[model samples]
Target chain A: MKYSGWNILKQALTGKKEWAPVWHKPEPKSHYETIVIGGGGHGLATAYYLTTEYGMKNIAVLEKSHLGSGNVGRNTTIIRSNYLLPGNEPFYELSMKLWENLEQTLNYNAMVSQRGVVNLFHSDAQRDSFVRRGNAMCIAGADAVLLDERGIRNLCPFLDYENSRFPIKGGLLQPRGGTVRHDAVAWGYARGSDSLGVDIIENCEVTGFIIKEGRCVGVETARGNISANKIAVCVAGSSGRLMGKAGIRLPIESHVLQAFVSEGLKPILPNVITFGAGHFYISQSDKGGLVFGGDIDGYNTYAQRGNLPIVEDVCAAGVAIMPMIGRSRLLRMWGGLVDMSMDGSPFIDKTRIEGLYFNGGWCYGGFKATPASGFCYAHLLAKDEPHPVAAEFRLDRFKRGHMIDEKGAGAQPNLH
Target chain B: MIINHPLLGPRDASEFIYLGDASLIDRPDWNSENAAQQFYEYLYLRDNPAGTIRELWFHEYGDRSWLVVTRNTLTHEIVNVELARDIDREEKHSR
Candidate 1:
C-alpha cells in the first residue's frame, strides 16, 4: 500500500480501521534466487535494491530476530561523509548523495535532517589534521567548512570552550551531514522490498551453510533448509561466527559498542558535536533526548552488552566536552555488537566460496554506510562485480596489503 | 570486571589494555613457507566464542604485566588470570 496524504485522510475518515501492515510476514520457502542474511538496514536495503534496481525479485532476507533489533536501531543516528582517505571519501560521498534523496526515493518520511556535523578540534595539530580532512572532503565533492574558535562558539555556545586541559581550538564542519530516524530506514526498505515481492523471513536463525562440492548453495536454518543461487551474509558483528561455520575465519572482531540517550529536555544542540580529545559524539534527538555514544568496549566478544568501566569512561568523555550533560540523567543505554575490521574500514566484496557473498567488517560505523553498502552489495550480487565506488572494499585487501586504514590506526581492531 | 593479578593483588579491568584471544600469543613461525598466509590468519582471524574464552590483557596501569585472562564471554565473568610471561616460559620449556 503506497502511503499518501489522501490515503491517510481516507483512513482517518473511516475511523482508522483499514490500516495495513507495513511489511508482509511470509513463511520461508525452500528455494529462492538470492538469500540475504540479516534484515537490518543493510540487508533490507540490499533486498530493496536487488528488486528495484536490478529487477531480481526472487530474493529473501533472513533475520535471526525481529527487524531493527541490531545496530540499525542502537546507534547515535548521525550521518556524515567528511572522510579523508581516497579509498573512503568517494564512497561516503555517494552515500551522502543517496541520503539526500532517500526520502523521495522510498516515499517514506525518514526525517533526513541536514543540520550539519561539526568535529571539534582542541589542539593546533588536530586543527591541521582536520584542515587536511576538510580539503579531502572538498576534493571528493562533499561540502566542508573549516570553522575557527569564534565560529564554533557561535554554533554551539554551550560547549566547554575553555577547558584548560583540552581547550577547544576550532572545528571542521560538514554542512550537508546530519541524522536520520534509524528504524525508519529499515522499515521503509523492508516495506519497499516486500512490495517488490522479496520475502523477508524473521526469527529464522541460520545454523549452517549448505555446501555442495565446493560452493555454498543454501543455508540450514532453524525453520528448514532453504536453497538459493546466491547466499549473501551481512550479519554485522556476527559475521565472524556465521562465517566460521563454513570454516572461513573472517578478518573481523566482534566488539560491543554502547549507545546512550538522556531524558528529554528543551532542544539545545543545533548540530552533531564530536569531542576533539575524546571519543564522545552527541546530538539532540527530535524528541529532545540527547543521543550519544563514545568508543567501543575494548574487548572482543559477541555479547550484546557492555561493562561499567566503559560506561564511566564514556560519561567522563561526555562531561569533559559538555559539562551540562552531567545534569541530564541517562534514560537508557544499550549495546550493539560491531564487526571491527583490521583497518577500521568495511568490506563489500565476494568471498572465496563460490555463490557465497559477504558484506560486513563495518565496525561501529555501519549505520551511516547502510544505503551505499546495500546498493553496492546489490550491484555486486546482481552483476558479479564490485561497484565502481566500492571497488576498493575488497575482502582480500588485507592479504594484498591494500588495507583502507581510514583512521590510520594500524592493524588494531579495538582502536579502529 | 576486576582481574586478580598474580603479583599486583587485584586491578580494575579498565587499567588493563585488552588485546584479544590468547591464541594470538602462539604466534606462527615466521620462517614457514606460508608465513604470509599464517600471519594474515594470526593477525585477523579470531575464535570469538559465545562461552568461556582465554584472552590477552596487559596491565599497563598497575604492574605492567601481560596477563592471560580466562573469562566467559557470555557472562563477562573472569574465571582465571595468570601472568602471560609464565605461560610463554612454560610453552618454551615444553617445546
Candidate 2:
C-alpha cells in the first residue's frame, strides 16, 4: 500500500489492521535471470534499479542475514560530495543528486536531512587544500563554500578555537550534504524491489560459485544450488572472502572500523563537522546522541571489533576539537568490517568470468555512495557496460597503473 | 591488545606499527618475464584469511626492530613472534 497521509488517517480512524508488512519473506527459486549477493543497501538498490529503470525481471537478492546488517546500517549516516579528485568528484556528486530525490522515488521517508557538512581546517596549508577541494566540488556541479574562521565560529561557537595545538582556521562547507536514516535506505529499497516482483531471500548464505568452462553459471548456497544468468556480488566487507570462493583474488583487505555514540542530550551540533588535524568526524543525531567515528584499526581482520587504542585516539581527537563534549558519557560503540581497496577507491566492474560481477571496496565511505554504486552496478549488469560516471572504477585500474588514490597514500589500505 | 615482542617481552600493541602481510618480504623480481603480473599480485592481492596468518610489525616506540608476528585474524590471538631479520636469513638459507 502507498504510505500517504490520507492512508495513515484512514488507518488511524479504522482499527489499524489494514496495513500490510513492508516486505514478504519469499523462498528462493531454482533459477533467476540475475542474482545479487548480499542484501545490504547496495544490493537492494541494485535490484530496485534493475527492475524499475532497466525493466529487468527474475532477479533474486540473497542475504546471509537480515537486510541492512552490514556497513549500510553501521555507518554514521552522513552524506557529502566534498571530494578533491576529478575521478571521484563527479561520481559522488551524482550520488548526492540521487539522494535528493530518493524518498519520492521510493515512496518512503528516508529522512535525508541536508543540514550541510563542514570539513574543518587547522592550518594555512589545510585551508589551501580545502580551497582546492571546494573548487573541485563546484566544478563537478556540487555546491561548496569556503568559510573563514569567523564563518566557522558563527556556525559552531563551541569549537576549541584557542587550543595551543591545531587551532581553528577555516572549513570547506557543502550546503547540500548532511545525514540520512541509514537503515531506512535499505528497507525502502528492499520494499520497493520486493513490490516489483524481486525475490529477497534472507538467511541464505552463498557458500561458493559454480563455474562451467570459462563462464560463470550459478552459486552454491547453504539452502540449495541456485542458477542465474548473471551474478553480481555486492558484499562490502566480505568481498575478499566471497570472491576468493570463485578463485578470484581481489586487491582488497578487510579491516574493522569503529563508530561511537554518546548518551542522548539536547542537540548541540548544527552540522556534520570533521577535524582537520585528526581523523575524527561528528554529527548530532535526531535522537540527540552525538554520532562520531575516526580512523580504522590499522590491522587486517575479519572480526567485527577493534582495539582500544583507536577508541582512545578518536576520543582524544574529539576532545581536542570540541572540548564541550568532554563530559558526555560514552554510551555505546560498535565496529563494522570495511573493504579497504589498495588505492582506497571502489570498483564497479565485471570480472574475467563471463557472467560474474563484483562491486565492493568501499572502504569507510560506502554509505554515501550507495545510490550511485547501485545504479552503476545495475547499468553494468543491464547494458554490459559501465555507467559514464563510474567508467573509471574498473577492476583492472590497479593492474594498468591507473589507480584512483584520493589520498595518494600508495597501496596501503589501512592508511587510506 | 598486547603484542608479545620477541625481544621486548610483552608490550602494548600501540607501541608497534602494523605493516600487513609478511608475504611482503618476498618482493617480486623486477627483471622476471612476468614482472608486471607478479608485481600486481604482490602489491594488491592478499590472502586475508580468517584464521591464522603471518604479518609484519615494527617496534617503532619500543625497539628499532621488525618482527614477524603470526596471529589469528579471527580471534586476534598471537601465536608466534620472531625477528624479521632472523626469518629473512632462514628463508634465504632455505631458498
The candidate that achieves the highest TM-score relative to the unseen native structure: 2
lDDT, residue A109, model 1: 91
Please, what is the whole-model Cα lDDT of each candidate in the order they appear? 0.91, 0.94
lDDT of 1 at A352: 85
At residue A45, candidate 2 shows an lDDT of 96
Q: DockQ of candidates 1 onward, in order?
A: 0.74, 0.83
Calculate each model's fnat, 2 decimals.
Answer: 0.71, 0.79
Report model 1's TM-score to 2 decimal places.
Answer: 0.98
Encode model 2's per-residue lDDT on A1-416: one tens digit a residue. 99999999999999999898889999899999999999999999999999998999999999999888989989999999988888888999999999999999999999999999999999999898888889989999999999999999999999999997998898999999999999999999999999999999999999999999978899999999999999999998989889989988888989999999999989899999999999999999999999999999989898899999999999999999999899999999999999999989999999999999999999999999999999999999999999999998998998888999997888889889
**How would you class the docking of model 2?**
high
Which residue runs of candidate 1 sit more than 4 Å off their true CA positions?
none
Best by lDDT: 2
> In model 2, what are the clashing residue pairs, if there are any?
none
